[model samples]
Target: MEFYSFNKENGKQITKFNSNFVMSRIIQTDEAAHIGCMYLDKNGLVGYHQAVVPQLLLVLNGEGHVRGENDEYVRVQSGDAVFWAKGEWHETKSETGLTAIVIESDGLNPSAFMKLK
Candidate 1:
């Protein structure tokens, strides 16, 4: 698994048309993509399984732990993004609740836009 940042610090400030905000790019897929929000309640867990396609998990709120092929859990929180390659084993868990956006696609290539964490 690889970690990326989607925090405001990694985004581009937009001052066009009198708008003031930072835009953090996520992904662009050449193929079909599945995007969804994941809500993990306290003590919740997403069991270990091989990714059917490349996956990117973007933390939206709260904190949690993630584990990849090596089975070493790492802490993750809001603004953090985690990537797992297709066929890689991974899992997500939270002891204090967490919410995230999950993006899956065979054409995922996060490195092209996201900054490494």
Candidate 2:
């Protein structure tokens, strides 16, 4: 069992993200799972990117908008969750600031599940 807190201030910042956004990696495992937090200050934006693995983003505070491959943007707020499939291109931005949790798992696949006989 593991116990941890998602303290924004304690996390290490990821320099790979766009200057308009802040990303912190909280946890990464050999099992191909990783967890992180993203913060977008007012008027901040994350440029277009593609997901190499399945990812889920859960809003923890504030609000933002996300755009997918279709180029359609959708509003998101605290408590909302968004899913991005592998290879999907997406981006995010906030006019009023936003905080979110990001979870990614490259090893999690439907084929890994087995049915009991």
lDDT top scorer? 1
Candidate 2 lDDT over 45-94, as tens digits, reads: 98889988877676789989888887778887765666677898988899
For candidate 2, give the lDDT of residue 101. Answer: 81
Measured with C-alpha atoms, the lDDT of residue 95 in candidate 2 is 98
Tens-place lDDT per residue, model 1, 9-116, is: 999999999999999998898999999999999999999999999999999999999999886899999999999999999999999999999999999999999999
Global CA lDDT computed for model 1: 0.96
Residue 5 displacement in candidate 1 (angstroms) = 0.4
- TM-score of every prediction relative to native: 0.97, 0.64
Whole-model Cα lDDT of every candidate shown, in order: 0.96, 0.67
Ten-residue stretch with the least lDDT total in model 2: 108-117
**Which whole-number lDDT from 0 to 100 does residue 115 have in model 2?**
16
